[model samples]
Target: MRISSEEELSGVVRDATGPLCIRGGGTRDIGRPAPGAVIDVSGIAGIRIYEPGALTLVAGAGTPLAEVEAALAAEGQRLAFEPADWRGLLGTEGVPTLGGMVASNASGPRRVQAGACRDALLGVRFVDGAGAIVKNGGRVMKNVTGYDLARLLAGSWGTLGIMTEVSLKVLPAPEAAATLVMTGLDDAQALRAMTAALQSPFDVSGAAHGDIGTLIRVEGFSQSVAYRSGKLAQMLAPFGAVTVERDGESVAALWRDVRDLAPFRGTPGDVWRFSVKPSDAPALVDGLRRAGPVERVLYDWGGGLVWVETAPGRDLRPERLEGHATLMRASTETRARIAPFQPESAPVAAIAAGLRARFDPRGILNPGRMG
Candidate 1:
C-alpha cells in the first residue's frame, strides 16, 4: 500500500493486524524477503527543517538521500557519518531514502572515525505496530531522559516499526581532504599499513584496501592534510610499494567508488559482509580463498569490515570459514540454501527476540527480515 500521509499509514498498519514490509525505493529488495504487504514510504518525502549553526537536520522518513546531501551541501554542511552508497554495488539506482539508510545503519569508509548512522541520528518519530505515533530522542544532542528508542530503531531494518521522520547530526564540510594510495601489498600488509595510519594523531577519516591498492584519507586544513599524508606514508614505508595521490577530486572519486563497492558491481556471484577483529582478516580471506575463487575483497575499518564476493555456487558458511562470516547480499537461491546471518548464541537470540517483542508485539512488521 502506498501511504501518502502519516495518518493513512498508521490506519493501514492498524487495520492489517499482520506483518508489514516497509519499502523505500526498494533498492535492497534482494537482501531480505518481504512476507507481507509492502508499505511504500517514499510518498512521505521532503526535508522538514535544517539548522546549520546547530548542525542539525530533520526530514521525513522517505526523503531521498540525494536530496538530503544536496540540501546539506547548500548550507556548507553534510552528514558527517557518511552513509554507504549501495546503488553502484547493487547495480541499482542511487535512490535510497534517508530512513532506509538509517534503518540499515549503513556507513562507509569514514565510519572508521565518524561512526555509524546510529551515531549521527539525534531523534526519530515512528509509528508502532499498534498504530501509535512514538517519538524518541530530541532535536538537541544531550537527550538522555528516555531509553534511546531512536537508536534502537536505527538498524532494526523496519522490523520494529515504520519510521515517519528523523533528525540527524550534521557537520561542517571539511576544509580539505586527500587520500594516500599504497599499492601492491598483500591483505596482511595492507591491513597493517591501515592500522598504522589510524594509530597516528593526524586523524585519518577513511581507510580502505582492495586487493590491488590501499587508500587512506585525511580531512582537515590543507596544510594538516598534506602533513599527515606525508607522515602516514613514512609510517607505511615498511610495507613496501607506496604512492600518494593528493588530488581532492580524485580522492573523493576513489572513495565514492569504494563506498559504493563499484569494483564488484554486476558480478554474477554472492556478496558477503564479514565482521571480525582487524587482525583476523588475513586468515579469514585466506581461508575463504582456499574454499573457492574470490572475485574481490574490500577491507574497511582497517579490516574489521570485509566485503567478499565469491564465484558462483561457492558456499561461504561461517562454520566453514575460520572466523565468522555473514551473508550481507545474496541471490534468492543462495539465500534459500544458506543462512544469510551467522547463528546467534542462545543469549543473544533471546535478547533479540525480546527487543522484537517490545517494538512489534504482534509480529506485524517485517517478520523474519533479519533472520
Candidate 2:
C-alpha cells in the first residue's frame, strides 16, 4: 500500500492487520525479510519549508534525498552530517530518501567533526501503532526537555512508527575543501595520523583509512583550508608518504568513494560495519584478521567506524571489543543463520523490548528485521 499524505497513511495503518513493512525509496531494505503488506511512503514527499537564513528545512518524510540536496545546493547549503547514499553499495536501483537516511541514522566521513543524522534532526511528525498522530520537537536546533522521542525514533527504522515528516538543521556549504593522503602507512600508523589530526585544532572535517591510503579532510574558507591542510601535512609527515589534494571537486569525490565503501562494492563477500573506539580500531582489525581473510577494511569516524568485507559466511565479531558490529550485506541464508544487528546486553535488551512493546504493541511493524 502507498500513501500520499499522513492522514491517508494513518488510516491504512489503523486498518492494517498483518505485519507492515514501511518503505521509502526501497534502497535500504536489505535486512531480514519483513513479512506483510508493504507501506510505501514515497508518495508523501515534497519540501514544506526551507528557511535558508535560519538554516532549517522541513519536508515530508518521503522526499527524495536528491531533491533535498539540490534544494540545499541552490542556497549554498547542505546536510551537515553529509549523508551517504547507499544505492551503489547496496546494489539497489532505488533512490535514497531523506526519511530512509534518518531511519538508519546514516553518517558518512564528515561524521567525525559534524555529527550523525540523528544529531541534525530537530523535529518529526509520525503515526503511532494505535493510529494516533504524534509529534515531537520543533524547528529549533536545541531541545533540552523530558524524553527525546525524536531522537529515539531517529535510528529505530520504522518499527517505532511511520514517520510522515521531519525537520533538520542544515549548514552552509564550505567555501573550499582539501584532502591529504598519506600512503604506505600500515593500519596502525594511518589510524595514528587520523587520531592526531582529529585531536588537534586543525578543524579536520573528515578522517578515514583503508587498504588503499589514509585521508584527512578540511573545509572552510579557501585560505583557512589551505593553511590548516599545510599545517596538518607537516604534523603528519612523520607517518610516510603524504600527498595533498587541494582541488575541491576531486576531494569531494574522493570522500564519496570512501563514504560509499566503493572499494568493497561488487566484491564477493559479506560486508560488516563496526563501531569501535578510534584507538581500538587497529586491535579490532588484527583480531578479525586472525579469522580467515578480511578482503577490505574501510575506517571512518576517525577510526571509530570500521567497514569490513569478510569471506562469505565468516564471523568477524570481536570477542571482547567495546563496540558493536552489524552484518551490513549478506545473502538471506547467511543473514538468517547469523545475527544481523549486535546483540544487546540483558539490561539494554530489556529497555529496547519495553520501548518496542510500548510503541508497537501488536508487533506488526518490521517484525524481526532488527533482531
- Highest TM-score: give the candidate number: 2
For 213-301, candidate 1 gives per-residue lDDT tens digits of: 89888998888888988888888788886677777788888888888888788787778888888988988889888878888899988
> What is candidate 2's lDDT per residue for 237-274, written digit by digit as tens?
88886889998789989999988888987888899999
RMSD of each: 1.7, 1.1
Error of 2 at 213 (Å): 0.9
Q: State which candidate has the highest lDDT.
A: 2
The residue pairs found clashing in candidate 1 are none
CA RMSD (A), model 2: 1.1
What TM-score do all the candidates reach, one by one?
Answer: 0.96, 0.98
